[model samples]
Target: MKSVNFKKKLTRLFFVLLGVTLVYQTGRTFFLKQEWQARNCAYEMVKLLFPDAWDRACDQYGLFCFNGSEKPMQKCTGVVESGSIILIHGLDEPGLIFEPLALALHRKGYLVLFFFYPDDQRIDASSRLLFNNLSSLSLAGPVVLVGHSMGGLVARHMLVDPVIDYAGARARTKVPEISDLIMVGTPNHGAFLSRFRLFMEIREQCLLASDHRWHRLSGFIDGTGAAGIDLLPQSEFMRHLNSLPYPGDVHCHMIAGHIFPFPVNMPEQFQMTGNQTLEGLLLSEKNYFLSVLGKAGLLIGDGLVSINSSVPFNVPVTLVKGNHKTMLANCFSGSSRIPPAIPVILDILEL
Candidate 1:
């Protein structure tokens, strides 16, 4: 009789959870489609910030270049301005996604160098371009690197593996000394969702659709590009990147969010050390797909990245209560709440 009663409760709980997952997925799918299908607005934002850069926008491959007062695509011969902050965006993101954050830093008197890269370039390739670009900057002062998602991967490579020259691409000069590394919702480990077969296929195509030829001819990076390959669970790039320890010479601060509202009453997978609060990181549902995937000892994280993935092996983790996207979106006016990371970064950098 007790077993029967317990099963009934379990069944009720399952339906409640199912309703929550469905609602979240419905909104999530709409958001994903909106991001991928939306037209690129890179130029408009740049023009809004610097009216002079408006005409130069058309010349740039995308909409705008952050070379700062320099003509598009021309060699940036300017000295690296002091109090400069380099911002790199994550996968399926544009430099403008960081507008709010940049505005906040600007108010604090920072010269923001926003970097834009292909949506699907591998870490190795992305880092190579970054290395080449930074090598030429000839910085006049120390700089802080702020990376979101895969952006952290590029910054990490700069710290521990600057010599990676993919496709025979090499750094012409040494990258400037990095004072601090700040990562928000970065997947130091691969995301579990990247392993999903259907999601993988769709993501691969969306990545491929971003090509100039694709746009002009009406076309994208699959998940196997120089960058996408690294996002998969336990992929070769992840293993390689994680193999290197966090550089002791530089301090890296991290921030992440948990999606679920309830924690103490959640599933077994949501459990944390010493029954720690899972408020900042845990998925809401544990359906068949989650159950099958959870068997590999998967964890509850910010819905996109597992906590095990966000919390670097040796580096510290600061849990910010939110989701994967919102944690780094403190800069967005619509984002409303201030991201926990912004304060941490400002404090560390003494800004």
Candidate 2:
């Protein structure tokens, strides 16, 4: 036992020293990028050199990102059966943000894996990351995929888009067999906020740059990465993504948040709290995309995504109370998952 402990200590020390050396050598290159980009690159480097540097990295970025595959099965929630459920987070958020939901599902008995992707890159790239990692996991039984916000778009490309088949002419890979797919607060029809041409243009330059995706994204209000950019209403990326039929044999379900009121909806019908309700209507009524009220006054979305954008065609969606940012309390922020959504998600697992 002493020998094993000694070996572990030595290994940790060696990595620490190696990390310092690499940082010393590449610190200049890492420093030159934008603040967020620098932090992102540094985090990736530390992740490779030091196994336990995640907390520090996560703090700087304010996202939940940990792969729980190696955790002891006994400690996992919902251990009733032997199956896996992959959780993908929405735009600019981390996978681990689903802690509340994941734990609840785990108690019900499924091995949950939180999948994280680089927000700075394209949706296709994110999807590729998810598929590639999933291919390596040796598991038995059907796998359920749950994506929140922008994550749902990523999952769609991964399992539903035939064009994005992660196979090349030289080497073909097996498409992941998905049993069911659940999207929470996903913008299936695209969001109105991303429709602004100026913001979209600026985002394009930032995300498509050759050097790094995060280079010029500073100062934009919750500016999205490549996938987020694609979620723009009427954008070409969205058009192509939606052009294809929903692929695979996976069962699909959706969850939409309606805690906030918008301009086009019947004000009295929407459940609203606080003084911001009237403000929401005024702002949304003037929004270029949302300005025109529907025959039934337009109801604004859960702060960010409108109800129309959240609901996907032909997919059954459970409407819950809460705004976009409050749906899943993140690691950095102590906000907890909205209580009402829990049972709905749990019910999906049984389906």
lDDT of 1: 0.59
lDDT of 1 by residue, 1-351 (tens): 999999999999999988987686455444442432232233233346555443342233221225333233333455766677888877655444565676668778777777655545456666766766676666656778888877888778766773653212223335566678888778887775643334544543354354322222111321123344467654666788878777776777777666654343334222234344433345545575554444333365577776567766445566666676766564355657776567666776793
Q: Model 1: how large is the Cα RMSD against the reference?
A: 12.9
Model 1 ranges off by over 4 Å: 1-77, 165-173, 195-214, 217-226, 261-298, 330-336
Error of 2 at 245 (Å): 1.2
Q: Considering every candidate listed, which one attains the maximal lDDT?
A: 1
lDDT, residue 282, model 1 = 51
- Per-residue lDDT for 1-351 in model 2, tens only? 999999999999999988986675355334323433444455445456554444332322311223334342222222223367778876655344576777777677666766755654556767776776665544456777888887888888777556656333113334435778888878877875643334444544453342232332222312233444466655555787778766546688877766644343433223333343333533334455555544122246676777767665555667666666556543243554355566777787876
Cα deviation in Å at residue 144, candidate 2?
0.7
